[model samples]
Target: MFSPKLLLISAIAVALVGSILAISSLYANAQNDEEKAVNSRGMGYYQTTGDVLDPAGSSGSASTGIEPMKYLRTFNYGRVSTLPNGTTLREFTMIADDRQTMEISPGVHYNVWTFNGTIPGPTIRATEGDLIRIHLINNGTHPHSMHFHGIHRAEMDGVFETINPGGQFIYEFYAEPYGLHLYHCHVQPLEEHISHGLYGVYIVDPKTPRPDADEMVMMMNGYDTDSDGENNFYTVNGVPFYYMHHPIEIEKGRLVRVYLVNILEFDQINNFHLHGNLYHLYRTGTDMEPDDYTDMVTMSQGERAILEFTYQYPGQYMFHAHKTEFAEKGWTGMFLVKE
Candidate 1:
């Protein structure tokens, strides 16, 4: 019933519509492929899964037996001094008088001698309402004091009036803001003391409960030395090359969360890179928000990052400073992915 001219026009329109749909489908497919590539290369958002080791014994309980948020403790044995040149220097022996070097990194195996002979001395993981008691002992000839980075009490702040060599002071105060934090000596020559390794990480996890898995804390510190050289050292839980203490051990498809704190005394920036997985940075210092998610993050001095990622591949991956130079200079750590 239709004429040849009308039929030809209708056919042409159909062909044009079909061609448009085909082009759109191809474009969508290409986009999907790009996303897959990025994720497989550990460059995008991807969920990780794995088994968590029970910190307890065969009975499956942590050995420490200390309740999750009960009590926390630490010791600070440092020294402070006023040099003849009027450069007030606060120095602390990383090595304790006992001669046992604290484990700074897990890979180093042998403990590196510290100013007080202890890597990060000791950790104080407490809750918001718990009172923190730190006994500062001046075993060295110089006088020293302990100051909490973000803590609130003025009396217990460890100012000059409250610190002295051979004199002990107990800092008693309740924890307020919760998140990754730092504690160090606030004497005149702070750069000298921190360079000598007289600082540590302090964490106050939110009162809320978290999933069952290993809890790891890392502190990135830098030192400027005149004799040897200037370098940055990544210490896990307070020991340089102590990555072994808090190695990320996981089975295929396990969720892991890492709390990274930067206690660097200088203005150097740090980039945290996870080699084989994508992570979500859920919190920063005392600020927690949904927008903090990211695969890579940067932290300046006095900042903190709380990131969670999963392991899918079965191999050993590394988490280190993306600065390249820092990683090459031994400012790196490891993460093991097991099947």
Candidate 2:
């Protein structure tokens, strides 16, 4: 008689083979589609009144010199809206697209999938108790969805709702318990999606509001250049050694607040180290009181904190991950203080 273990192994192998074959066929089709000749449309302005009325005797041809009838707005970040009754409404329209062989630093290039053509796409800002409405347009060739780490309803949750190509969805939620957060594509093969640069920083300011200070967003991310289940290059924003080349300028005797976020994949722990300074750290930005005061802080994947500090003396200061190898690999930056 055949052993039960042998039969189970045989069943698993057959299922794996079937799945591989299906995926291979899909890839072949996608390759073919990418090779098709695409007609380029000339840029022109057209009147859009939300009506489908066509011009008289107009032929559907590129030579017509008429642009497509669609509502288009400038791609930007940190958009806010307010009602007369003291309520705030934050709105954002995100377009997910993929670019081929985009430059990471100066000479390094990677196939980057992006939102609004930028890695670590636009930083979204909102105040506590405000409502956020995100209009996600799936203009790319694959399915995508936005999953935000905030309190929201199940339908508003992007996990079970995958929008196909040319589809759209509206995600609305109330921003509560203000803190540092992030948003990313939550489709299947989640790691691949995130590694492709489909993530961004989301900030919810506290209700009572901290003291006025110069603020900046620093999102830690890494790229798996060889697809080898390891990150070869790491960055604070998107480019390697960007801040090292062009240090962020700050004024002396002024408060500086940083929204620090870590979304680096394949790494369980990433820490921040500041040279010649200490910060009042607010863990997760959920409380009014700081949890500690220190020069270095560590966070696991998807963790964040709000760090506030002031430079008493003016000089150039460096900041990087405590993991020396990570800083050498490109996770580094500097703060140039002015007298």
The total of clashing pairs for model 2 equals 0
lDDT of 1 by residue, 99-120 (tens): 2333223222332323344444
lDDT of each: 0.55, 0.77
Query: Model 2 Cα displacement at 6 (Å)?
Result: 77
lDDT tens per residue, model 2, 48-109:
33332211111111122111111011123346778698778888999887544576655456
Error of 2 at 110 (Å): 0.5
Specify the highest-TM-score model's number. Answer: 2
55: Cα error in model 2, Å: 54
- Candidate 1 accuracy as TM-score: 0.62
